[model samples]
Structure formats: structure tokens, C-alpha cells
Target: MEKVINAALCFDGNETQKTEWLDAIFSDVDRHYGYSNSFEKAIETTAGLMPQAFLNRVFQGTEEQQNRRSFFIRHGGIRRSPLSKIDVTDLIAWCQQRNTPEIWGLVASGIMLWEKADANENGYFLTTSAVTFLEAAPDPEPVLHAYADRVTPSGWTGSRADTMQPRADAIAELSLHVRQDISDAARSTSNRLAMEIERERIRDRQRDEDREQRFE
Candidate 1:
């Protein structure tokens, strides 16, 4: 399942680049992992349906993050667990035990991030690129960690569907966490401005009152 997703994302990236990236990841799966089960091949066979953008994002992140760990990773994205729904902590531990390198960790983390990133509310569906990237991922642990550090829930953000019917609700859910942070900031600024204006008005009113009282 995850491999299929990785394939989908790989199909989304630059075709020439993806060819090289996929070759490396699949080679690793076959080498150290001993996975000759054609799972990777299945993804390659179905590359036509995948989105290029999602794959590009996956590759961009995977390549950049892998380099940070000094791993000259050829694979464009992270690796993933064989199980569709497995424990991330356990998965990470498993990778470490297998003598997986730091670059492998980055791939794992990228997969996790893609899985958790915003998807369509109606279908929970990701773009073809995202699916391809997931399919190509080597492991899931490092990707999860990187996601926590870099892409985890931040302040408010939005997307195109935020305004529509079904998405309005999802948009709210998606935006609320971040939106509240922005709202807090806006409210603090508004309060300060209001207070300042009120203080000036009060001071002016008091001066007028004092002058009138003195005239009498």
C-alpha cells in the first residue's frame, strides 16, 4: 500500500530524475531489505495515474533533508512501512536495527509527512504525486521525525477548498488550530490600539471638562 503510494508520488516528479531516484530506492529494498516481492514493480507499472507535483514536493524535501544528514541519497523520497497502518515508533526502531543509515531515516520521515499532510476532505485523497512519493519511500521513521520538526501543526493556514460547501467544515478544522493563533495575535493588537485610543480620548475629554469648569 505504501509502496504504491510512493510510486504514485514518483510519477509526479521530473521524469528523468524520478527514473534515477526510483532505481536507487528499489535497489536498496532488494539489497539490504531483501524485498523481491514485486511490490515496487507494481507501482512502476501503474505510473500513468500519478501526479507530478506531489512527487516533486516529495523529492524536493527528501533530497534536501537527506543532504542535511550527509547522505548522498539517490532516492527522491523516504521509505515506508510494509503495513498500511503500523506504529511509527516501532517502524523507526525496526529501521535502526536493520542498520539503516541517516538518509534512510529522512526518507521514512518524508513518507510519514505525506501521509499526514492535508488531503481532500471528501476522499482523504492525495494528489498522484503524493501517492507516487509514498510508493517510493524507503522507510517511515526518519520521515516522521522530520515532519514533527519541520511540518507539524503550526499557526493558521488555508487552501483553495476552504470556501466551498463540504470543504468549509474541513477548512475550519484545518484552519482552526493555526487560525486561533493568528486570532490571538490580532486580538492582542486590536486591544492595544483600542486602549491607546481610549486613553487619548479620555485625556482630551478631561481637559475639555476642566476648561469648562474653570470658565464657569
Candidate 2:
């Protein structure tokens, strides 16, 4: 399953080939899992298993770092460029102006910090740890509030904080859902495999008994 997902990720095929590969994978998953809904859920589950650090390395790393990664090197060497060339300060400014939570969440998830700064400090950057934690958290509100409290100036509460908070919360909520779906699918697969093993064991036992009776 991991191999299939990795192949999809590493596939350097053109649009038609990419679509074909994806369709084939989706068909196989549907056949095996007997899912009524689209196979996109299964794909999302597979993506949930990916390490946060790996995501950072892929999307945020320097050119040399990207080149060193085996998967990228094998898959035609990092085709998409990093989203931004700007430093953390510039990124924060850009995000502030855009005021988009999705973009903020993307920055939180993808950006890697060269130097850690106090949340209180001017031009403070979001750390990879904070972003990953928020994404995986089942209840992201508390964490988001805590994060906001830490970064926001004392006695300051306004529209900016309100807007940013919900956006971050939304990102975390979406991540939590994906993780849950992945967990459920994994459990379902494990149970199916277990049942197959048990059936095989019973069949083996029954065959042995029949042979013994025949010999007797």
C-alpha cells in the first residue's frame, strides 16, 4: 500500500499518465476495501501517514537538501519550486496582508525556521513543531488560543486575532478529520486480514483431519 502511494507521489508522468496511475490505484483500493465512496479517502489516509518533517523537507528545504532526498532524486529531482523565496519576516508580512487562514496554515505546515524566536519578539516566526502539533491535534482550539495568546501583544484583542484564530482552527480541524479517517481505515484493514488468516487456519486444520480419516 505504501509502495503504491509512493509510486503515485514519485510518478513523473504527464497529465494523462498521472490520471491513469491515479485511477488504477483508486480502482485497486476500491476493489480491496469495498468502499462505496470515492477512493480519495483512502489516498488521504495514506497521506496522513506521511511524516511532517518529510513534508517540510519536500516543500521547504533548500535546493541542496531537496536534491539529497532519495525520493525526489528518484522522481526527477524536485519539480515544484519552494512556494516562496522570502525569509520568515517577509512571509509573515505577506500572510498578514493576505489574511487568509489557508495560506497561514500552509505556512505553518510547510515553513522551516533557521532560528527560533520568542513569540513576543517582533517578526516572530511559527515553528514547525507548533504547526505539526496543531495539525494532528484532535481539539485544536485550545492550542490555537494558547498560540495566539503567546504571540499576541498583552491586552490586545481585535479583529486580526479573531480572524486568524478561526482560520488556524479550521486547518487543525481538517487535519484531525483526515487522521481519524486514516485510523479507521487501518483498523478495518487489520480486521479483514485477521479474518482471512483465521479462515486459512481453519481450512488447513480441516484438510489435515480429512487426510487422517482417509488414512485410517
Candidate 3:
């Protein structure tokens, strides 16, 4: 998944300069997944559906935070047994086992700051670009559905869809998560701003009252 994200980065970036991301992805996948699974092929497989922006955000944290994210991504975003869900203690313990003793608070903050999952809290269902490396992806069969309308004054109206592909399902799940995250952030920010505005208004009223008392 990291390799796939890095390959997505490769698509976004200019080839002129050296980058750490491109470096790591190329080194690991070719050596492991064989030359058949080239980065280009990976990107092509995940073209329109990849949550490129959200996956990039996963790498935007501190070095230690990035390590935590790496583990989460590798596990396909499942917070397995004993953990129940993505809890702070579980992540810290996991990191400790790997000898990555980054501050527990920092790890906790990372989880809260970036975590988004289903309503059931079952999985952090973003950036599941699994088709790249996996030889046998869930339900490889492509289910296509198409609709066409008669052309009137408004030219032609038609659409194509891969109705049921594992990759498409992954992408749709990601879109829902991203949308909910954005909505929640916007609501939280707006609420905070409103509270601040009300606080300022109360302060202004108190200041006016105090001035009147002084004048009297």
C-alpha cells in the first residue's frame, strides 16, 4: 500500500528531482512483487479510484506517526483482536513491541488528528489500493453497467460504470470516509468560531457596562 501511495506520488511529481518516497517504493516492490508489478501498472490499475489526496495525508505526520500509519495501512486498516478498535494503548503497545518508543501522546494525537472510519468503526476504509500487489483481489470479475438516452437538443447522454469491482468498492468506501471527515471538520470549525464570536460579544457587553459604571 505504501508502495502504491508512493507510486501515486511518482505520478504527481516531476522526474527531474530525487524523492525519498519514489526511492523506497521502487526498491521494495520490484525486488519482492517481481517486475510484473511495475509502479506504472499499479498506478494504471488504480487510476481514477485511488484516494490519492487522503493517502498522501497519511504520510504528512511526524516520523513516528508515519510509522504508526505504516502499520495501520499494512494491516488493511483493521484494528484486530484485543484492540477492539483503534485505541491509543494498543497502538502504543504495538509500537513499543517494534522498539519504536515514540511519545504515547504524540501517537494518540496522530490517531485523533487523522483517523476516519465507518459508522461501525470497523475499518479505516481509505486508500485501499490493494489490487497493485495482490495477485488475487476480492472478486476480480468486472461488472459493467451502461445507460443511453436518445439525443435531443442536448447532444448525447450516456455513462459507463464498473458496477461491481473490489477496487471500485474500496474507492467508494474511501469517498464516503473522506466526505464525512470533511463535513465533520467544517462543522467543528464553524461551531468553534461561533463560540468565540459569542464570547467576544459577551466581553464587549461587560466592557460597555463597566464603562457606564465608571462614568456614573
Candidate 4:
């Protein structure tokens, strides 16, 4: 069977909720968290990794597992959805509505999770209830924080031209570094294995030579 990657995330309150929900569905080591910039990225990344996997509104696997998994959410409210539970189809529909490749890429590969911030009169702080899902997502990009570069940073305007290209370049450099590290590790492993094989071959040769000398 094909493997599915399911990512997860939620506000602190709903932390227990998403975990329980996903555990019921995936029920394996295939589940992970904190992989992306946001909950959306986690969901998107999960879905993007497996475009062909059928994501149903309700998991039809096993009730025994569901009840067992629900133990994690004993303190939190049940993570239930009112609308048709968002699945791969919902993500595809979301992308279809936007009609943009960029957005589609995100919906297709992004693993998004977030809660709705509570609000009331007098501007009182409210509970943050976030939805979590493991859908597809856009590809990873370099992070460029203008505030990090600013000599004196203040609140964000959210309207500035993003210097994402430079950030992307930096990420590319970092990716190269990661690739080099992986290559080095692979080479080291191969060398160790080869050395062992060569050592065994030399021992076998020595044994054969000794036996021949004894016969002479």
C-alpha cells in the first residue's frame, strides 16, 4: 500500500484535539508535527506528498482505534467540524475556487492548522480555536524577515514589498549545505561497509594461503 504523510498543528487549547483526530485517521508513525511555518503548511505538505490518496470526510477505519485515540482529548473539546469535513477533495475545491497556481500549490502541498481567535465586545481577549488539517502545500521557500534586518523594528505594516528573492537565495545556499552533509554521510557509510568487506576478503585469502603452505 502507498504511504501517506499526515502533518498536524493547533492552538495550545486544541493541541490535544488535533492529535486525537489525526491519530484516529492515520494511526501510525506516519504522523508528524511542526514541519512548516504554519498549520496550513503542515496540512498542505501532507496532501501534496500523496495526491492520489483518498481523503474521506470521516475515517472509516476502526471505531476501536477512534475511541482509543480520543483518550488524548479528554480535557479539550472534541475536534469536530460542522461542514463536510475538509479532505483532499475540499482542498482541491479550495484551489479551484482561487484559480491561481500559487494558491493551488499551497492548498495542494500546504499543511495548515489554525484556530479562530475569540472576540467579543469591549475587545476582550478570547479563546483561540484553530482548525488543523494535513492537506497538500506549496513548496518550501526561504524566510526573509524585514524586521530582522531593520535597525529599529516596530509593528508590521503587512504591505511592504517582500524581499523573498534574497531569502530564497539564502535558502538555496542552506539547501546546498544540507545536500553536502547528506552526501558526506552516505560516503562515510559506504566506506565503512567497503572496508569491512575488504577486511573479510583479506582474512579469507590469508587462511587459504596458510592451508596451501601446510599441504606443501
Candidate 5:
């Protein structure tokens, strides 16, 4: 709201509207009020992070859940458009339209739940960890940056050119995660095999012990 009020001075609104709405900003401002340099940068930095924007649009009750479920039925995994994909046959790209690979990776890692009725028919329906992740996110980044910049200030800097380096780094990090996920899946399979072998050996030993005790 404070950002909106200040931005209006340079952007849009009548004299009366600006005069009245200027009060929407605090008469006195703080460091936090000037967190982002401008509105455009603020929107980009805080994508899917604003609870006020998200909560209002979120599905609430059974009827609304069912309403959204119908859309998921038509498409897959809340992905509204198939045209955005690199190729329509590229299932991963299609899925990435809404939920990133990290979200799907978490589900694949067994930290969350997933289901598919068919090839394109999917339900991501993961809640508990998702709720926790959402709650923990908003508390840190701004505060951490503020304190970290005591010597050299670099608060919310989406407006800066340095942001491009971070973006490239993020893509590189995500690519590494793909390999990590593959290794994790292979480890899970190997561990499952080891578990079954142990169980079979234990069963054999127990059976032999029981037979010996019967003879005694």
C-alpha cells in the first residue's frame, strides 16, 4: 500500500485522488517502506510470495476444490496451457509451466504426494510440507539482506544488473539438481534391494532356529 501511494506521484491518478491516496502511505516512512526501488521490480522479486494476493485467489472449500479439480481433469497438474511447451510431446516442459521441476522433484523424492489417472491426467495434491514451505519463505530474505548489508547495502536488488548473475547461477543450480535427483532415485532402489535381502536372510535364520527348537 505504501509503495502504491508513493508510486502514484510519478505514475497515475488525479490531483484529488493523489492527495487523498497519498495518506495511504505512512506520513513518515521507514527503510522497509523503500525496500524495492520501484513497483515493477517489487512484483518480479515477490512472485508467488505475496500471501495477500495468493490467499484471496486460493481455493477454499469442497465446492471450490471440485471446481478447480475439473480444470485439472481437462488439463494436467494445474498446467492451463500446452502451447507453452518446447514440444507438446515434451511432458516435462508441459508440467513445468506452472509448478517448477523443484515442486515435481519434491513429490518424486517422496516428500510430497502425486497421482495420475492417465498420461495427462494428474493431481499434485501435496499440502503439509507445501504449507510449511510457504510460511517459512516470507520471514527471511528481506531481513537477512538488510543485516548482511550493514557494511555495503544490497537490500532488495531486483532492479540491479547483478540480478542477472544470480539468475544464471539459479539455472546452473537447478541443472545440478537433475543429476542429484537421478542419484537419489538410484540410491533408493539399491536400498530397497538391500532391505529385501536382509529380510530374506532374517526369515531363513528364524525358520532354522524354530526347527531346531522344535526338535529339542
Candidate 6:
């Protein structure tokens, strides 16, 4: 069976309602391409794309897990912070329209749980109430603030003054460079996957032709 799986977001509802939503989502997905047995299986298939080290951090409940989850959200173009109020119904609608992979939803749900738990070191329970709130709330707006308005020291005055400005500039430059690099890498990976998919289609077509010729 193909390893990849897709899932839709679940919104606020009672146990029966939630189960019905999930069932509908799964049934729709299966109608297109039958592979996944349940939402958990779909999520696991999505998680399988990550490096083992990253998966380790996620499962270990370490601070690194938060960073990784944040990275996924950012890279996936989910601009709003998980800490902000999110409308679950809108999110589910968006995911269904886009056919978003289940993995992204899993990461997002994890981030919500993390934020709700107040970054508790021990980890938070994934209660049904929390999931309901996540799905039922309205989509959050971007939190905009002017950087210049924030309080800061006028200038460096100590012995470190000479190097501080240059160091800061270099760090800022490197941050931009790293971001560009990541974008390029993601694009390259996407292109490669597309090529592989096309090749598979060509092979399937060729196999069908061969079978038809043999019968002739």
C-alpha cells in the first residue's frame, strides 16, 4: 500500500458529532485513493517524512519539539501563531479545499496543545474540550506591532561597543541568507518529487501498453 495519507481538520462537537465528522473525512479521502485506515495512521504516515532526529525531539517532549513544531507551521505558510485563537471550522474548510496532507494538521494540533498547556514541561493532555475550542473558534488575526515602538537601549557604551554593531549586522545578514537557502531547498525538493511522480505515471502507462500488445 502507498505510505502517504491525507486527513481533514476536526472542529468543535460532541463525541458522536466529532466521530461523524472524522468518518466523513476519512470516507471521502478513501474514495479518492484507498490507503489509510484511520486518522492516526494518516498522521503517522505524514510524520514518517521527518528525519528520525526531529521525530525523536517531538516524541521526547523536549524544548526542541516546540521549535520543530513552529518551524513546520512557518514553512507550511501558517502565519498565525498557534497561541492565537483559531476558528476550527474555517481551518477544516481550508484544509479540505486544499487537500492538505494530514501531517500538517497533526503538527498544528500539537502546537495548539503546547500553547494551551502554557508550555508546560511535563506536557499537556489532549482533552476533547481543547480540540473543540480549536475547531469552533474564529480564525485569529495577525498580531502586528511596530518594532521601533519597543523599548531598547540607546547605544552600547561598554568595551563591547565597537564589535556589537558589526556583529548584529552580520547576524541579520546571515538570518536572511539562511531563510533564502531554506526556500531554495524546499523548492528543489518539490520539483524532484513532481518529477518522480511523472516518471511513475509514464511507467504505468508503458506497462499497460505492454500488456495490451501481449494480448494482441
Better of 1 and 4 by lDDT: 1
How big is the RMSD of model 5?
Answer: 21.2
Number of backbone collisions per candidate: 40, 0, 0, 35, 0, 3
Across 1-216, the per-residue lDDT of candidate 4 in tens digits comes to: 112234233223454564464444444312322111223333434334433231331123466533332221111112321112245456556545555544432232222222222343211111111011111222222011111121111232321222122222222222332445433433443344345445645666787789899999
TM-score of each: 0.22, 0.21, 0.20, 0.19, 0.20, 0.20
lDDT of 1 by residue, 1-216 (tens): 656555555444567665665565444544443333344434433232332321222234354342432232223223432222323343344444446455444434333333223454332222233223323335333332332232213332342222122212222232222445433433443344345445645666787789899999
Q: Local distance difference test, per candidate?
A: 0.37, 0.40, 0.33, 0.31, 0.30, 0.34
Per-residue alpha-carbon lDDT of candidate 5 for residues 51-128, written as tens digits (9 for 90 to 100): 222222212335544344223222222222111211212222323443433333221221121222246632223223
Model 2 C-alpha lDDT per residue in residues 77-123, reported as the tens digit of each score = 12221222224444455455555454454444323322234455323
- The residue pairs found clashing in candidate 2 are none
Using alpha carbons, what is the TM-score of model 1?
0.22
How many residue-pair clashes does candidate 4 contain? 35
Select the stronger candidate by TM-score from 2 and 4. 2
Candidate 2 vs candidate 6: the lDDT winner is 2
Q: Rank the candidates by lDDT, best first.
A: 2, 1, 6, 3, 4, 5
Over 4 Å off, model 5: 1-94, 98-181, 204-216
TM-score leader: 1
Model 6, range 1-216, lDDT digits (tens) per residue? 113232232223354653464345334333434223344433433333322322333323345544444443333223333212333443444444444354333434433332223454322333343344333323211100011111112344432223222322221222222345433433443344345445645666787789899999
| After superposition, candidate 6 runs with Cα above 4 Å error | 1-83, 106-111, 115-123, 127-216
Cα error, residue 68 of model 5, in Å, equals 16
What is candidate 6's local distance difference test score? 0.34
